[model samples]
Target: MSPLARKRLGRVALNAAGVAVFLFAVFPVYWMVATAFKPNDQIFTTSFIPFPDPPSMDHVSRVFTQGVAGNSIWRYLLNSTIVALSAVVIGAVFALLAATAVARFRFRFRTSFLILLLIVQMVPAEALLIPLFTMVKRLGLYDQLLGLIVINVGLTLPFSVWMLRTFVAAVPKELEEASWIDGAGRFTTFWRVLFPLVAPGLVATSIFSFITTWNEFVFALTLIGDQGKYTMPVALQFFVGQRSTDWGGIMAASTLMTIPVLIFFLLVQRRMVSGLVAGAVKG
Candidate 1:
């Protein structure tokens, strides 16, 4: 084939591959939503049905009214929101400060600290689950939202710090120095000038922390035993029975569980984009 024809063929192949991957990802979400609208009788038999010919709100209504696994879906959603938002807020404060320090100050073990953070993240949560369980139990924190928040913070903090550190270091230190020279305190410079500049870093890190905590299952299951205190991920387990799984209810619950996260991302998505652009421009 001619060189021009070969390039055209390659481009066509690439586009085809991209579409295939998109479909692979999107099909599952489409299937989930489709299944959520399905009636119980139709769910197992017609799992691949393209669209509900006569969609029923029965599953969603039950999810809202009757709940599943012993607690209302909304209650689990509320618990998830409280835990996730709290984790995000706490993690952001630490990440921002830690990122600033790692980016700005050169000190002994600076590289080691960054590496250590990565190492901690590498350790499997399952591996530490037993020890963590015992520790929480001993501290009288087991089954408490406070305990979950602490663990989530520890799990998410290191990665968020490293991510924010990159954004922080990308910023020009001269701007900070100028503020300092003009009689601004370190806190003032960071809060007044630097914080606004790094809003994207904060948004990105906060989203990471929120999603991590919100979707976390194993830890929530291990730590919290009470149905009233269950996060959405753990609470979704209630849809299963020994004889038969409540597939429709599970799908409905999972679908509802995603709403808060979707809303949160939509709200902060603009800031995240702006933060990236600001970082690139300032860098």
Candidate 2:
């Protein structure tokens, strides 16, 4: 084949692969959304229905009206928002400071500190549940939303520090030095020069932390005992029963649970894009 023809064929093949991957990732989400609007009769039907013939809001209505676990759905949403946001805020602060230290400063045991962060990341969160639970109880934080926030901050911190370190290191140290020469204090140099540049990595890590904490099932379930304090993930579990499951309700609740994450991404997407471009230019 001619070289141009081969190149064209390869481009076409890559486009097709991209489309396939997109569909593979999106189909399950589409199915869940479709099921949320489907009537009970259609949901259990033998044959496939690509779209609900006549969409129903019965499941969504039930979820809002009936609520979950003796509390309004809003309560659970609020709890989740509180915990996830708190964790993200706290985690981001610590991660940024730690990342800056590791990237900028020459200190003793720096290599060992970085290695320890990696080691913590490698440890499965599930394995630490027993010990964490015991510690939280001992500290009188068990069953409180604050405890969950603290746990999430701890859980996400090491990875955030590790990830943000790259962003910090990517920034030209010369910029900070220039700011200092211009009479900018250490705090001013960080806030004005470094923070804006590293914002992308911070947002990325915050999103990961938020999502991780928001959808976290094991810790939220184990740490919190009060129904009033249950987050969305835990609230969703109330839909399951021994004999049968409320699949429609589960789908509906899940759909609701996803909105905050989508909104968060939408709000930060522009900033994230700008941050990436800024980092590239600065680097």
In TM-score terms, which candidate is top? 1
Residue-by-residue lDDT tens digits, candidate 2, 46-142:
9998997799999998888888788878889899999999999999999999999999999999999989987998899999999999999999998
User: What shift in Å separates residue 136 of candidate 2 from its native position after superposition?
Assistant: 1.1
Per-candidate TM-score against the hidden true structure: 0.88, 0.86
Q: Which lDDT tens digits does candidate 1 get at residues 1-283?
A: 9999999999999999999999998888777888889876678783457886689888899988999766778898888888888888988998888888898899999999988987997899999999999999999999899999999998989878877887788788889999999999988998888998889767877886787799899999999988899998998888898899888888888888777677878877765565445456657
Kindly state the number of residue pairs that clash in model 1. 0
Q: Can you give the lDDT of residue 238 in candidate 2?
A: 93
Model 2: residues with Cα > 4 Å off, grouped in runs: 1-20, 262-283
Candidate 1 runs further than 4 Å off: 1-14, 46-48, 260-283
Once model 1 is optimally superposed onto the true structure by TM-score, how far is the C-alpha of residue 41 displaced, in angstroms? 3.1
